[model samples]
Target: MNQRRLFIASCVALIATAMSFAIRGDIMGQVQQELSLTDVQVGWILGAAFWGFGLSILFGGPLCDLLGMGTIMRLAAAGHIVGALLTIVSTNFTVFFLSTVVVGIANGLVEAAINPLIATIYAGNKTAKLTTLHAWFPGGIVIGGVLAFLMTQVGFGWKAKVLTLLVPSVIYFVMFMGQRFPATEREAAGVPFGDMFKELARPLFVLVWFCMILTAGTELGAGSWIPTIFNRVTQSATQAGILQVVWINMVMYLMRQFGHNVSHKIAPTGLIAVSALVAAVGLYLFSHATTVTAAFLWAGVFAVGIAFWWPTMLGITSERFPRSGALGLAVIGATGSFATALSGPVMGWISETHGTAQVLPIWSGLPLLLIVIFGAIYMVDKGKGGYKAEKIA
Candidate 1:
């Protein structure tokens, strides 16, 4: 696929991720109020979609590799449209929550399918390329949050706000339908699934998976819980809406655009390690925030810290280890997706029963854990490889 087509398709895919999370921030509070939910119940609704996405991702990856990225993209676009309609039609918590899950599954399936697609399409420039591709996600979040602001003003309401996301779903489906899928390295080499999966499980592969779990867990856990945390800390329901996710994604969006460039000049490993500490400080500042402006700034700072972690790390796995193909994407994604799925409710329960202050440990501990683990991986890779592997393809 040409870069133009790839960029269009990636925008569609990233929009789904942005939309999934867009709901998590502002609209979630609206839905909860309309539906009359408890904190635990809200967590379930928020977490349910991720759970659907995480559980089904293992299947989505292989299917994409088997059926094709264009097919997966079209199917997932249809899902977002359906999910939007379901959310609009919902009359009860069951229906509304179920709709969120549908959206989550669609988003999860798309992530599983496309991350590998980009890795294959761009091939040699996986780290920089993936960072650029993932940048669309946070950028889309900024769009979604801003759209939500406008939608509410024109009497669009929450349901209308959700259904509006269908516009891109349609456009994405059309683009992908006319496009050609880039061939996976395994397919070009005619390797079978059994062989590809077996090779993906090697010791170094395990280290990559470890890094994915920690990074994903920390990032998603922090992003997902930020609003609830803000609401509790400052007791301002209004500001927390676009502020939390919007701020987080905005900083994330910007860094993702520049991360690879910065990494090239500095070093991706050193940048990641330092970024983790920045994130920890941001989270601490966020937890202690007394003013809304301070909170938003701190949130953005934290997002910047987490900004490059996912794309850079996933780029490492996919580019540095393309021999694993779609299965490799599946395994690494599984670890983090599952962690995010679990963290949602866990954070909710803590915030609900133990109070939001308890979230400090969860959010703070997550990045610290990632910094430690990825730092270890950095040491191990440096010691063993005795060389910085610059070649991506």
Candidate 2:
């Protein structure tokens, strides 16, 4: 498949996943309220999606490599459809949670398949392209959240709001159906899958794999909780606009779209270090913002710093350790995305007991730590043989 087509497919995939947030967060909140859920049950209602998304991804990436992207995508999409239906009919929190698990399975499959697809398609500049692809994630969130808000104002029922997401799901499924399937690196390089399997446990692969874990954990952990933190800080949903994820996401999106060129020209490590620093400062400023507009600017600044971390790390991993394949991404995702899964209740507890305002700078310190880790890796790898300093995978 062509890069352009791959980009379009990625955008659609993001839109689908982003819409799930609406169903699980805003729309599901309405559902839970109508059903009179306890606060703990409501937390389960929202957190189930991420839990499912993370746990399923542990298996999904390797499975995608084994079964092929087409098969994985189709199966996951089916799960999504089923989950969506289950959500519409669910009467209690347990049923709602189970439905979201199905949706989460679908999300995990999407990440596993789509991340590698973008990497394979833009093999020469994976970081920039990957960043561009991930940008759609937050971009989709903005669109979905805004749409949900409008639908609420206009009296659109919550069930219909969820089912509407089906339109894009079907369309993307069709897109995948018609397009020629892309090959994994194993396929492209004519390496046997057995050989790829043997390489997975090598020391270099392990190093890259661990970094992927920490990198993903750092990025997703903080990113996932900020919105809820926003809720706690702002004191109401209408005031919730004061701490929008969209600001963070949009900055991330733009940086990713352009980050590839900047990354390739400059040192990836330097770029990452600088971006992280810039982001830390942004978050620090965010802690101090007293009003919505100030929070927006700081959030955007924080987004700028975060924008390049994941794709660049992936680029670094794949380029430095080309043999690891989808399993590499899967491992890191398992650890980090799961960390995101745990962060919700943890943050909730901290907010409940410690006052929500205290969570900001503490979380902000995390990315600052990332700058150190990434910088050290950059120093170690710099000027190595045939490891051209400025090139990206």
Q: Against the true structure, what is each candidate's TM-score?
A: 0.89, 0.89
Please give the distance, in angstroms, between residue 256's alpha carbon in candidate 1 and its true position after superposition: 1.0
lDDT of 2 by residue, 41-102 (tens): 87776677777887777788777677887788887778878888988898887887888889
Candidate 1: clashing pairs of residues: none
Per-residue C-alpha lDDT of model 1 across residues 299-381, encoded as one tens digit per residue? 87788888998777777677556667777777777778888777666777878787777686556766786677667766766
Per the 3 Å backbone cut-off, how many clashing residue pairs does candidate 1 have? Answer: 0
Query: What lDDT does each candidate get?
Result: 0.75, 0.71
TM value for model 2: 0.89
Summing lDDT over every window of 10 consecutive residues in candidate 1, give the lowest-scoring window.
Answer: 384-393
Q: Which runs in model 2 stand beyond 4 Å of their true positions? A: 1-3, 190-219, 231-237, 241-243, 352-354, 385-393
